[model samples]
Target: MRTIVITGGTDGMGAALARHFLRAGDRIVVIGRSRAKFDALLATVTSDDRSAAARAEFLAADLSLVADSRRVVEHLQAKHAWIDALVLAASFIRQHRHITAEGREASWVLFFVSKYLFVTGLAAPLCAAERPVIVNTAVPGTRADAIDFDDLEMSEGFTFARSNAQQRRANELLGILAVTDNPDLAYVTWGPTRLVRSSFAGEVGKSMKIAAAVLGTLLGQRPDVAVRPIIGIVDAPTPGRAAYRGSKELALTVGDHDDEDAARLATAVEDQLR
Candidate 1:
């Protein structure tokens, strides 16, 4: 069976994706930070035939730190020589700006930094796979803000929208540069305009929670439908671009942004990493 590695596979979009892949007879190696959620997911798998547990494996890691991300991949490298796909669905929304232990913004670390580390670290095994693909869950219609070289963290004015925009742009640039640099592996970003349900909203304040609910009911689509792009891309990924919620071939790379801009943003990201 082909092996798929998923981050944040214990809940929300990640968990939904994992269930679908598992049903397809693929082995899943999930990386998560929550033991409770992991156990719950395992319970769901094992509840229907205990032997199904063999098809699933898990590793616990706090992906907010770059070092920890590398360590997680190193651990994986020790176990498996090849991996068919890597789906990064790990994310959380912090209303106020918070800095990670790595001195990076929490959302940036979760959404982009950890993903970059995971993808780069697992490059060798990915190349070894028969058909390796990288699927990233991106927020659709995200504003691709150019990273301010001076204030990368936006300590000046930190709103969820602005921070999320920064992270989304970083992810886009990373995909562009990575696909260009590593032609052996195909990368696809799945952008859904809105998702019907999100576990990410469960941990927020009551007001935000209400808003999340309203949005889900009003503007969102079912999780399965919202995740259609991810499923499609995993089955067949385009090397250097992304797909939105609707339409198969008609996709906007980085959500209708420019290729040259993605390249320039990649350069800026490289500089930031240095």
Candidate 2:
């Protein structure tokens, strides 16, 4: 049986994927923040102890902290020798800015710091496996501008739109780096065609919250449907590429300067993580 580690696996897209894989007989290790959500997900899987398909475990963590992220990887690696799949579906989206105790913006930390470290820490074990997949959950966001190298933390100016743009761009950059650094491991960043309805915006502005609620009501896809791309991504052919579920091309059209920007962004990420 394959072993998979999915962050934020207690809710939304992550939870949906976890449930799907559990039923498929894969061993899952879920990481999240809420003990209640974690317990609920575990209970669902282990409801019938006699069922062969149900097998899973969980670790509670606030992923916004890099130290927590390091601890999480250590915990997982210590428990398992190899991981068949690593899903980065847990994300941070917000209207107002929030910072972690590490002095980094929560959105940036979740989207960049934690994600980068988790992959780096797990790369060795993933490579040790016969075939391993790294699926990163990303959304198509505002990509007209480049990421701010000097003020990545958004200390100077933090706007919801700007942060979204930076995070999406960061995903592509990370994907490129993953392909370059670990050629033996397959990596894909999944971009869903529709929005995922998550309770991540509880602290968002009133207007933005209303907008999310309305959009969620009108156009959101079930987390299970949205996460289908993730399953497809993991099953895709070797020589890892970005994938859009039920779509043709694997590229995310950023801009004319995306190549240069991606290189710079990768360097920045490496430096920051170091």
Candidate 3:
């Protein structure tokens, strides 16, 4: 059985994927902020299958704090000999800018920076695995222009859509640069164009909740159907290529300058945080 570590596994697609993998007999180690919620999911996922529950593990962590990311990676590194796949599925979309103790916006820290930290810190186990894959659940709202090199933190003016698109772009580009560093591992960034009505969809306000539900009903697919691409991504082999997922094959594109951009992003964020 493949050993997979998933972030944001307590909710949204991560939780659905966790249950799916567990039922498929894979060892699932999930990271979230709440053990109580995890316990509830564990019960539902396991159901009558006690063995499946036993195969699953959960680590509670507030992923918004980059300071805690290292500890998370260290713990995972100590526990597992090799991580078959790392699913960077944890994300947040907030209407307002909330700066953390690290002085970076919470959206940037959670969606982009901490994701990079997880992969960089856990590079060892990832490389040691028979088949190493980094599956990033990235949204395709904005292109490369989303990142403001001058205001990476969006300190001047911020909108929820603007910040979310920026982080999503960062993650997609990060997959591009990450493959160069870890040639043995495959980096896949999933970009589902239609909304999936995830847990994060409704957390903002009532209007957003109604919008999400209506949009989901009209345009979005169920979690089972939407996550099929992700499952395929983990199962397939596409090393050193940053693959984008969508309905049409023509939409899948890669970048030639992602290495430089990823380096700039990495250095800027690391330096800023320090």
Candidate 4:
């Protein structure tokens, strides 16, 4: 009987995770940007079992806004004092850079800003869990990239590849920092080998879409297969850094990129968040 909170829960990895967790009898709260999708998922969950009505709740907001992230934290905290797990599966992947109304790059806001606020804002509640876990979904694309401190939002020279890479890098650093700053909390930043076929990725530009399609067709694994290991990581007796491939732990952090680069990226992220 744990409370699990997932962003971007209306679809894709988030949705799949919600279903799996619900079936396992964990209370879940899902936040998404679409009311229709939220309602639709709620309807299905309720239909499966009326008890799901009591166990599950849905909220809709564009997380690109810091205010919205704050509101989400407040709303959920008001409902429950403790959260067993916080999974940030929401992502921003666009071919062209889009600016949020808040004057920050939309993709960066989604990947970095919203994620940071959610984790920091909910730290107390999440820490209340017997064994709390914070999981940030990331990819190998993060590599060993350097953060552009001068243009933190990538407003000056933005590209889909660079923006996505930076966010993935940020995810890794956040995991390390979260673990280091709060010794009681367990953190894991992992990437599945398969591309999750989700509406979230539908917003990619044409060329990128073609590239994704090709990669997905060639190397994509089913969503369930990709997410099973994450569930295991969440349920592990103790968590620090766990990587997985098809429910088996793999060495994604080993030799894929340089340790120095990852450390520098983590430091930059800490400074930017400060």
- Clash number by candidate, in order: 0, 0, 0, 0
TM-score computed on alpha carbons, candidate 1:
0.86
CA shift of 252, model 2, Å: 3.5
C-alpha local distance difference test of each model: 0.74, 0.76, 0.78, 0.74
Q: Where is model 1 poorest over a 10-residue stretch in terms of lDDT? A: 246-255
What is the RMSD of candidate 3?
2.2
Worst 10-residue lDDT window for candidate 3 reads 246-255
The reply for model 1, stretches above 4 Å from the true place, is: 140-145, 201-205, 217-220, 246-274
In model 2, how large is the Cα lDDT of residue 216?
85
- As for TM-score, the candidate ahead, 1 or 3, is 3
- For each of the candidates, the C-alpha root-mean-square deviation to the true structure, in angstroms, is 3.0, 2.6, 2.2, 3.4
Instruction: Give the per-residue lDDT digits (tens) of candidate 3, residues 1-274.
Output: 7899999888878887888888888999999887887888789866768888878999888888987777798899898989888888886667788888876788878888889888788888888888789888875435766788778889988988888888877887776667777898887777675787677632377787677778887988667667777777777756765556553322433445667878888888778767
What TM-score does model 4 achieve against the real structure? Answer: 0.85
Shift in Å, residue 118, candidate 3: 1.0
On TM-score, the stronger of 1 and 2 is 2
Residue range 9-75, candidate 4, lDDT tens digits: 8888888888888878899989888778767776776777778767887888888887788799889
Question: What digit string (tens of lDDT, one per residue) describes model 1 on residues 1-274?
Answer: 8889999888877887787787777889888888788778778767775776788888888887777787888987888899989988887777888877778777767777788777777888887887789887765445555555456667788787787777766776667766666686777666666555767532457898888888878887776667766777778765555645544443443445566766666565457567
- Point out where model 2 deviates above 4 Å: 48-54, 140-145, 245-250, 254-263
Best by TM-score: 3
lDDT for position 20 in model 4:
82
Question: Which of the two candidates, 2 or 3, achieves a greater lDDT against the reference?
Answer: 3
